[model samples]
Target: MRHHSTQIPESSKLSWMLLPTKKNTDTVQSTTDVLIKAGYIHQSQSGIYTLMPLAQRVVTKITQIITEEMERVGGQRMSMPSLLGPEAWKKTGRLESTGSELFTLTDRKGAQHILAPTHEEEVTSIVKSMVRSYRQYPLRLFQVTRKFRDETRPRAGLLRAREFIMKDMYSFDIDQQSAISTFHAVEQAYRACFDRLGVPYVVAEADSGNIGGELSKEFHFVSAAGEDTVLTCKCGYAANEERARGRGASGADMYEVEGSEQRVVVPAMRRPNLLKIKQAWPDCGELTLEHRKSGEEVASLGQMIALDEVCADGDYLVDAAVDGLAVEGIDNFSNVEVGDWHTAQSGDACCKCSTGTLESQTAIEVGHIFYLGDKYSKALDLLVQHDGKRQPVQMGCYGIGVSRVLQAAAECSSSSRGLRWPVSIAPYLATLVPLENNMEHATSVFATLSNICVNGARVFANNVIVDDRSYLSPGFKLHDAQLLGIPITVVLGQKFKQSGHVEVQLRVPRLEIATCVAGVDVTGDGYEYKAFVHVDQLAEFLVCALEGQF
Candidate 1:
């Protein structure tokens, strides 16, 4: 995409009104702000955005990467209806379970419908009708499409938006063992996908929220504007705050459930983790938990109590702990053990590693994978005959936030002047910036580099941008390159006008590429560097640089 051919921002439209004097500062709330300031995206509403051409290029590249990874794991791409009937979600009990976060509508026929948030329910119903025997086990289906979440307060641009692009894959296996294997296979694919982005990320144990699952993990990009809190220890133990454990949180014994009608009053407000009781007993609708912030003494070890002694008189705690807690088929609150109830914090001692201190950081959740064991399949009655018996199919779902990832990558690489995008997802591989009077010479170089290919991938042409906007000053063009976070930049100015050598600047580090060019002149002042390569040697230099031959 050529800067001159860009017609949306005419005249002072390129004005850096929102450009912060510093990068990643409080002035810049998120990459969304930077993208908007740089004309890469435009805010259409509170949580909705219109991706400009530059943003589209980045998203397209991200989507392509996701597609490759999904396919590598035998995923077949398919599209499901964006507007879905409420019946499937209802059958799975997610209709009311989803609550306000769901976007629902009443058609002219008075039928309720919802915009797709995730495809679990829809895909399960489809597989239920289509596949019957175990012969079709290990099937994988995926799609890259827009999704809606009606966020109460969308923030950080694409990071938490009402409308977004997501790549969701659903897998079906004949049994739990097969499903676990398939989950790991897709996990590696997710790892590959993030690794290719060239951005730093972390995989953490996570709790499956509304998405019912037996196992879950999250892939996150650490960022200031990120919404999720992740705790990591140097020893490689990591988990979302909700699921993280700390040595301080001791596993304590609690009264066992006796009669099905006994009700235990837990301090819902003081301990958020205990509220997951709803999930602990999903099948028993009678097990209701009211969320309320209670006193610190609510359920501390100091408040231990006996189940038979539990009182119905609303005196929440007795004998220093829980007295009456009852749920059908649930023998105890053993699931909320010591460490499980504690949300790991910045200074907590890592319980798993025992040697490392857990450090807390905020991160954007770019991808999530869940192992659904007989949840959706059982709810939708998707069964398969195996060993001469019909059994519920095991399933897994994997998702990568395509748009959020674009924002996250930029946010992760943000710098003082601008943000350095990973080479794989940058809008352009490199930008050729020419001073006002050097368009002709820069165009010649651009044309030449446009045809160069390296490592089986074309590094130029569509992947590169030439700032030929003659109306802008050379200084403005150069600054724009830095603002857009172009991984590599080539400048043809007075140096090129007099001599045949051009300047190359890397966005992230201050380094010299003199090795790529014969008779290369290199100079640097610590934070910035310039490598002058003759016009004749520029192509070879870039090919080697792009190929990582350096």
Candidate 2:
């Protein structure tokens, strides 16, 4: 037998009242079911999802934007196979270097195959065989296709996925100067793309990593869900996590090591704390510790620690070549951290801001462009004859993570209640509904709104759905309307019948709502009164509102 009690503490009673109870559980469940039925989208794996109709429509529009931008940049588009041959990757050494990261298999005839993580080797191979001459000094080519990475740990919805879409591009130039220009050109094109999408981003120094390049830059869109960390400064200095260099003052040389200076040998005490040694021997002044591991012929002071400190078990001996008495230790060459004297300050000069100091911020990279130079062309024998001299074609690569943008947008703008999409990416601009079961009033209002939609007004972009289904309760319809987050909603029912006008509700204001009552006058031919502010006016308002926001 079980007994239950409804007991509440005096102090907790008020807070409990504010808590959401189980009474709304059924409503939430019903909403989820409706969303699934409407085919918004469904996650099959941790980060992989199947886009339903509603989601598909949004993504299709985004893809169209990307296509337009790529074309505008003079990028010649093409499609490559999702599956690729292993021979090209093997020749580049990535087949084994990338190891299990490369998804590989054997065909029926036992021919090696690999799902490409990137297309550099393949594109270079094709160019090697097709191009011949310096005349084709510069070339820009691209493709929007599906790529597989088999990420070790995929999470964060579409922000990190095993299979995703990417716009990978390759550029070729005759020389280093031309390659640098091509890189800048691609960077500009990427900026235009994100601008059109209405997402804020920053370009920062980045490491090419295993991608194999001398220089690289990443475009990071500010969002919490972003996986990469960015170090930013008021001086307009931004850099990727791997390439982040904390601003610091190069400290003065603590100790000078003259070739002939002699210090007593201490074999049992092989490691001496440079800082402590200098502190104990104040007359010796600052300490200059050598980092033997740096492999440089000249020994430079890498770091300094407290003097008189005994060596730990982990510490190792680096016999100071100067006198052999001042032994160095493993702990001397550690990385610098924040609060160091060398860190960048607010007043530092910004390359972008000119005289303005740099400011630091966090952001996620959504796109990147790399100029490959002739790394691939040289490997694959890709060459062109120009003036009777065969030369390798310069190449560059560009990438945009399509799925990541959606998650980034969601991360950047959303509240506990629901998501507030940007105007350019909102699922729909308006939802039309009648407040109560007044069929005549509701029907008449529908006709009026339909005309506004047909006129290509800004209130709706062909995605409006009128809930004329009479069986549904007004409460349920209202709940759906809110969940959809439509910018505007119109209610025509019993309330309007007495008032003799339709009610227009604008959901544009943040956490607040406003309504305007517009008179409804039906004519003899069944024509309703035209709105004082026509659909064109509504369109203009929407455009202006969105323009100011993004």
Model 1 regions lying over 4 Å from their true place: 1-29, 249-272, 275-339, 509-528, 544-550
Cα-based lDDT for every prediction: 0.72, 0.55
Error of 2 at 106 (Å): 2.5
Report the C-alpha displacement of residue 479, candidate 1, in angstroms: 2.1
RMSD of each: 7.5, 13.8
Minimum summed lDDT over a 10-residue window in model 2 is located at 521-530
Please list the residue runs of candidate 2 whose C-alpha ends up more than 4 Å from where it truly belongs after superposition: 1-39, 132-137, 249-360, 438-461, 465-472, 485-550
Tell me, by lDDT, which candidate is best.
1
* Model 2 Cα lDDT, one tens digit per residue, 98-169: 886767879999888888778999888776667665765577778878788777887666666777777888
TM-score of each: 0.81, 0.67
TM-score of 1: 0.81
* Candidate 1 global CA lDDT score: 0.72
